[model samples]
Target: MDFLTLLQLLDTTVRLATPLLLACLAGLYSERAGIFDIGLEGKMLAAAFFSAAFAYSTGSVWLGLLAGIGVSLVLSGIHGLASITFRGNQLISGLAITMLAGGMTVLIAQDWFKQGGRTPQLEGAARFEPITLPFAETLREVPFIGPLYYELISGHPILVYIAFALVPLTWWILFRTRFGLRLRAVGENPASVDTAGVSVVALRYSAVMICGVLCGLAGAYLATALQAGFVKDMTAGRGYIALAALIFAKWRPWYALWATLLFGLFQALELRPDLIQQVIGVKVQVQLLGALPYILTVVILAGFVGKAIPPRAGGEPYVKER
Candidate 1:
């Protein structure tokens, strides 16, 4: 491929990677705090629907984002209540949340918009547009750096930059802060955390809430930024892919970024089958390419790639007297 083509590929990869990166980080935070959240997909779906609905109604993308985050947090709170407060099975609780979101988004959409589970098409301030970076126009003729800067590095919505910047921030928070230490400790050994005079429930709740916020942003990006509005199940299993990415990254922030990008590259290739065939000089099945993320997930989970050890207390409810 030529340098320009390569830059185009990189640009596509970044766009596709944004939501996966956000959802992967969401799962990382929840799982690292001993909460196995299979409901990331659900939260994103719910947020996407609500964000789109609100944005279309109010003509403000910012309000839509806030609405998405609020809905996601409510669902996260439900999960926290069921798992932490009631000490129920975390997996089942997560599954319930996902199912609930799946059903409610479609139901509400059909009732409100009468478009068979799609919100009204968004326009103007309701949708996010790309922000051109400084020097992009000035450097458009500067050899290899020109296209790289203007084409690849510029012209994404602000959320894309925020998603990328979050990697280092998440890394720092999980490794460099006292809350990070306690959060990790709670996931590993809740009893030990309790003995140290910390509230295990509180930390786990906080982690799950953070997960909700990130998933909310991921949904908003999809509904308002990536597309004009929400459709039925627009998330389309990104949450599961993100979960797989979390496992693939072994719950590390930097690795999560790389893993999501790899998956995004696979998706980008799927979108451009001609490019893949050109690179390989062989006919490639689009179906197989589309299945790449799930295939990788199964491989990683089966330990064919490598052992991915989860947190010790993951998927278990903490009991103070146990």
Candidate 2:
């Protein structure tokens, strides 16, 4: 492949990787805290529509981003109330939230946007611009490395970098900080944490809220970074993929990133079916490529990679005795 062509491939890979990485981390945050976050897909979809609508209305992507996060927080809070406060089944509550968000987004879009469950397209200026550092720009002029720079980092949206940056940040927060310690403790055994004077309810609530924020960002990234607008059901089951990455990663942030990247590679492969066919010397149908990741997820999980241990007290609400 030519240098520029290689760079373009790499750039496209990063673009594809961004949303998955963000969603994986968002899943990591909630599941790590012992909350089953099956509703992530719904939460992201809701945020995507709201973010796109807000951006279209205010002509400001930043405002849209804020609105997206705000909406996700509200939805997640309702999830917390249902699952945590009412002791509702976590899986059921999450699924309900997902259904609610999906239907609500479409309903609102149809009612207000006048685009039939779609938002207006955004301007180029409204989306995030890729940052090109001076060194990278200079290197781009040098030939091979220039193309490599472009492929790897040159033209990605700001959130792409942030997603990569978050992996280590998540690891540090989960492993090194006191809050992380408490969060993990709660997940592992809220009753124990409660007996020790920590408020389990408070910790779980905070965890879900953080989940909301990250999922909101994931949604906004999908709408603003991956595409310039929103459509009905735009998440396309990526949220489920993110949850799979969490389970596959065994709840480690760095491992989650690796898992997400593998899925991203699968997606990149699907997007360019001809390349895979040429490399494999067989004609692989587009449908097969699309199904590959989920198939692999089931296979990997069944084999018990990383032992797939969930939090001991996951999905259980804590109620202290008076």
Candidate 3:
């Protein structure tokens, strides 16, 4: 691709990657705390529908975001209660939650909005407008930094910045802080953490809480920032893709960023159907581009990622005595 085309591709990559990054980090937090949450898709889908529904009704994106977070947190609580408190099977609980959301979001949307499983298109304050960073305009005339900043780095919604910022913060939280130490400890060996007076249940619940909020942001961004409104199955399989990225990155926060960006690049390729055809003399179907995440998931599952070991206690319901 040409330089301008490359820049455009990268810009789209950043936007597309933001949600994946958010969801990936969410999974990182949960799995790192010994929780295997397969319902990331569910929480995000529910949050997307609720955020768009509320935003359309209230004409406020902030309200929409809060609504999204609220629903996601509720789902997270259910997961926590089932797996951590009641000692239910984590995988089953997560799958049930996902199915519940898949049905409930569409059902509720149809009953309330009558838009065939979607809210009315959001507008004005209901949407997130891109914010131009400082000096973006002034630096537009400068050398390489100018176009790069103005076109690629600046003029994104605030959540984009937040998603990128969370990488360093997540690293710090997982590696630098005492709570982080305990969290990882619980994931690796809950008995040790419990022996040290830490509550394994509490740590896992906190991880779920953080996962919920991040997934909420990811979903909200899908409805209010990336698209104008929510659609049926809007999140698609991004939640699963995030899970795969978590595996691909070996649960490292910084690697999650790069992994999500790689997937986002595939998504960006969907927008330019002719570009790939021109480069390779073979046309690629835009719809098939969506399968990249699934392909990656399969590859990872098939042991291409042999060294990507998960937390020792992952997916096991922790019984304090056991």
Candidate 4:
């Protein structure tokens, strides 16, 4: 491939990976706090739909983004209440939340937009514009690597930066701050955290709510930044993939970022039908290529390197005494 072609591929890879990175990091917040969040996909889908709808109505992308995050946070709050406060089964609660969010998003979109569960097209200003790098443009006139930096790193949406930036912040939160220590302690043993005068339930609720906010931003990125507008179920199991990435990364934010990028590369390949045929030298059906990443997920989980060990108290609710 040519230099420009490689640069384009890198750009596309980052674009495709942003949603997964965002969602995986979002899931990481909850899971690291010993909460299993299987409903990330639903949250993303709901937020995407709501974001597009709000943006279309108000003609303000920022307002739409806030609306999306707000809706998903409320939905996630329900899950937190059911699983953490009520001590419900985390898996069942997450699944139910996903189903509810997905169904409600579709139903609301269909009823209101009348586009059969799809939103209207978005305007240019309603979408995220690519940001050009300061020195890369000037340096592109130098040589080959300069062109590489210019094309590959420059002109990406603001969300892409946020998605990558989140990795370090997530790591800092998990390993640095006082709340991070308490969160980790809660995941390790809620009783211990409670004994130490921390509110375990409150911490878990906060973690889950943050997960909702990240998932909401992820959904909005899919609609407004990744694509022009919302379509019915456009998230298309990306949330599950993000979950897989979270586990694959062993609950680490930077590792999850890399894992998400790998899957996103597969997604980018699937989008380019010819690339698969050329690279693999087989007339692989589009459906099969589309299935490759999920297949990989199953294989990775099924002892390719041994069983993945989750946090000991993950998915268990804590009831603290006053």
Tens digits of per-residue lDDT for model 3, 1-322: 7766878889999999999999999999999999999999999999999999999999999999999999999999999999999999999999999999999999999999998999999999999999999999999989888999999999999999999999999999999999999999989999999999988988999999999999999999999999999999999888888898888888999999999999899888988878889789898888788787777767776787666789999999887673
The local distance difference test score of model 2 is: 0.83
lDDT of 4: 0.86
Residue 270 C-alpha lDDT in model 2: 77
Better of 2 and 4 by lDDT: 4
C-alpha-based local distance difference test score of model 3: 0.93
The digit string of per-residue lDDT tens for model 4 on 1-322 reads 5567667777798999999999999998898889999999989998898888898888888888998899889889988988898999988988998889778987999999898888899887787778888987789887887878788778888988998999999899899999998887888788998888778888999999999999999999999888988898899999998998887887888889898988887777777778656666877777876777677667767868656667778988776657
Give Cα-based local distance difference scores for all models.
0.94, 0.83, 0.93, 0.86
Q: Write the per-residue lDDT of candidate 2 for residues 56-135, one digit (tens) a residue.
A: 88888899999999999998999999988898888998899999988999899999988888988888666665677558
What TM-score do all the candidates reach, one by one? 0.98, 0.95, 0.96, 0.94
Error of 3 at 12 (Å): 0.9
Best model per TM-score: 1
User: Whole-model lDDT for model 1 versus the true structure?
Assistant: 0.94
Across 246-312, the per-residue lDDT of candidate 1 in tens digits comes to 9999999999999999999988888888987788899889889778888887888789878789999
Residue pairs with colliding backbones in model 3 are none
C-alpha positional error of residue 62 in candidate 1 after TM-score superposition, expressed in Å: 0.2
lDDT-best of 1 and 4: 1
